[model samples]
Target: MLQQSSAALASVFDRASEDYDRTGAAFFTPLGRRLVEKARVEPGSSVLDVGCGSGACLFPAALATGPKGRVVGIDLAPGMVGRARRAAESQRLGNVSVQLMDAFRPEFHGARFDFVLSSMVLVWLPDSAEVLERYRPLLNPGGRFAFCNPRLTGQDGIPFVPEIFGTVMESVGVHPKTFFEDLDNGWLGAPDAALLKAGYTGIEVCDETYSLELLSGEDWVRWSWSHGFRSFWERVPQARLGELEKEVAEGIDLLRDSDGVIRIPGTVRYVSAST
Candidate 1:
């Protein structure tokens, strides 16, 4: 089941690779930078970025580590790996390499990395605890592991933007409660506890809220299909996708401010621990 889920996730990301973080929305890139910041990556460090989609976290870490350091990024999606590799080459980043690899079972020598980072990836894994343990051995002594997850809030127990998608999905007779339920179940309740259980120390968890500004409702629809939310968009039948998008656009437009910007608020939890 885990392998099947990973394959499905890779396929979804592969399909989304072209527009993954290209949408004008200030979401993934900003969050990736924030995670790198929280990780406190330094020059000459050896960094491993798991699930490095489109080099969001990978590039920043590479920049932080400077020319003397080495940054390796891995992803299960071949398209994502290809995109990251091209981006690295285009930028002339000789110190960076992106490879197609499974995050759950990373093939690396023990204690090979000074830092390991992931952004918005753990919540999708069914065995996050075991994965945390698996990643621990990859970090060298005193090395740090850092990652981020959405801090779900609101009456429906999800972020505001996703709540809108759920409501729109239900309007089209496709229930999204199961999806959100699975999401809620997958995210760790006490990430620090999980880290401690995984034999990590010096744990730190922080939360920050970010506002995603969309130029218009149409922009929101485009941004939705760019990231993991694409899964929800894919659930709608092709014949009903247009109808769903139109309604979602209208629904999102209603919440637009006087300046015509649709700002969706979400909180992200960043966690770091030392090996």
Candidate 2:
């Protein structure tokens, strides 16, 4: 099941690789930078970034660590890793390297890192506690691990666009399975206790709400197709995919503000812990 899930996510991300950053950087890049800042990385530190898509956190981390430090990035999609490697080389960042690897089962032995970081990756795992426990042993003594991912808020749950998309799919009698439909595999709760259970100390967790504005509702649909909500839409049959897309775009336009910019709602949970 783990392998299958990883492969599924990889396929979606791989397809989005070329325009992933261009389409969604307005929303994703800031969060990645924040996770790096929260990690408190310093010069000469060894950092590991899981699910380091397009080197968002990875590049900033490399810059933070400077010439004396090393930053390694890994992702399930080869396309993403390739893009990161290209970016690193183009910038002449000798201290950075990237690999295509599964975050759930990292291919490393011993506590080789001073800091481990992830952004919006844990929520996709089948077992957050087990995965956190596995990551604990990879951090050196007193090392820190930090991550940021969305945590659904209140009874409303999810963002406006995804909720509308899911409702449309059901309305069409598609009944496609979606990650948001199962919070266990797609969402996280208060994580400090889970970190404590995983043998981490100095744990801190915080939540913040953010708003994203697309040039228009069509841009929102394009962004959604490349980012967090892609997986849910992929489950729709190819024959019905066009219809679903149209319905989602029309639904989003209805919520646009007077300025003609579509405001999408989001909330992120940030966690930092020490070994």
| TM-score for each model | 0.94, 0.91
Whole-model lDDT, model 1: 0.84
lDDT score at residue 172, model 1, on the 0-100 scale? 61
Off by over 4 Å in 1: 1-4, 154-157, 160-162, 172-177, 185-187
Candidate 2 deviant stretches above 4 angstroms: 1-4, 160-162, 173-178, 184-187
Candidate 1 per-residue C-alpha lDDT over 130-240 given as tens digits, one digit per residue, 9 for 90 to 100:
898999888989999999987764353465474567788877666556555555555365677778889999999898988889878888899878877777778788998
lDDT over C-alpha atoms for residue 262 of model 1:
86
- Measured by TM-score, the strongest candidate is 1
Cα error of candidate 1 at position 147, Å? 0.2
Give the Cα-based TM-score of candidate 2 against the true structure: 0.91
**lDDT of each residue in 205-269, candidate 2, tens digit only:** 88887787776667777887775467656667888888878888787788878887778777788
Candidate 2 local Cα displacement, residue 270, angstroms: 0.2
**What residue pairs are clashing in model 1?**
none
